[model samples]
Target: MSIDITLTVNGREINTEVSPETTLVQLLREHLLLTGTHVGCDTSQCGACTVHLDGRAVKSCTVLAVQADGSEVTTIEGIAVAGGLHPMQAAFHQCHGLQCGFCTAGMIMSAIDLVTREDDLDEATIRKGLAGNICRCTGYHNIVKAVQMAAGQMEGRGHE
Candidate 1:
């Protein structure tokens, strides 16, 4: 049987039907066509499916679609504005944090959540925060730098 769910996604309220076993990643990527949230691994170890579930970073692959019923969900595609990118996404691009770009979306989403929750961010904190995300392209240095840069930008805006 299909379960009816109502959730706000990327600032849009959605009413959809999903099976009990349907995952958030599957709902976003397959059903909603929000392909930016990736699925890099079968295990939930990879943060490639990271997204903001009610403003907190979570691996979408690990979350059941029904579990997020009535919750707010934000994917990588949701963070940017019309003309400019989100600060974290811009930092990732500016710092060359991505190589193949497969993992960039999740990285930026995770970074935004990390920076949003933590203040006075540094290299160590950024690295520790990003422990869940794994980039096989050997781009950790740039990723850390991007997080740091985005943190600084977010801090300048004075919104914790």
Candidate 2:
């Protein structure tokens, strides 16, 4: 069966019909065409499908479309401002946090959530905060650095 849902995505209000079994990730990528939220692992083991649901990070694959009804969703494409990169995205680019770029979108989404919700983040804390997201490329040194850098830039932004 199909159900109608209304949600705000990337600052736009979207109303559509989705199957009861449709995941948020599928609603995003296949229906809405927001492919930035990748689908690395369908089982939610990998955080590549992460996005912000009501201002918090969530694995989109784990969230059904009905659960996101009447909610606000932020994908990687939504985080950018005025055609420029978000602070976290800029930090990732500056710190060389990604290779192959498969997991970059989810990493940035999680990092933004971590920095916004926590304070005085140390390397260990950053590592712990990002434990849910996995990067198979580098040793995560650069990812940690990128989170730290973005944390500074986003210090007073208060969940942007």
Candidate 3:
């Protein structure tokens, strides 16, 4: 049987009915048609399905649609604004943070949450913060640089 679930996604309220076992990644990609949140591993180790739930980065594969009811969810599609890309997005582009692009969105989302919670963003902190995410293409060198650049940009914008 389907269960009713309501959530605020990308600043918009969404109401739908899904099975109790439906994962947030399934809902975002299959039901809602927001496919930016990728699912690389079902075991929650890849971090490719990360999204912001109530201002915290979470693995959408590990979260059920029903569990996100009434919470605010932000996928990669909602990260930018009317003017241009979010700082992290721009930094990823500028710093060549992504290779193959499979893990870019989750990496950015996790780094965004990390910087939002801290004032000092250094290489070590950025590495530690992004430890949960894995990227095979870049070897994480460029990814780390991208996060550092984005942290500076976000700090300048007063996002934290």
Q: RMSD (Cα, Å) of candidate 3? A: 1.6
Candidate 3 regions exceeding 4 Å error are 155-160
What local lDDT does model 2 show for residue 126? 95
Global lDDT of model 3: 0.91
Q: Per-prediction TM-score, please?
A: 0.95, 0.95, 0.95
Q: What local lDDT does model 3 show for residue 55?
A: 89
Clashes within 3 Å, all models in order: 0, 0, 0
**CA-only RMSD, every prediction:** 1.5, 1.6, 1.6
Please give the CA lDDT of all the candidate structures: 0.89, 0.91, 0.91
Candidate 2 residues 2-103, lDDT tens each? 999999999999999999899999999999899999998889887999999999999999999999999999999998879789999999999999888898
Question: Which portions of model 2 show Cα errors greater than 4 Å?
Answer: 155-160
Per-residue lDDT tens digits for candidate 3, residues 1-160, read 9999889999999999999999999999999999999999889999999999998999999999999999999999999969999999999999999889999999999989998887777889888999889996756999999888888778533355
For model 1, residues 47-158, the per-residue Cα lDDT tens digits are: 9999999988999999999999999999998988789998888888899989998888888988888887777687898889889988979789999988888787774333
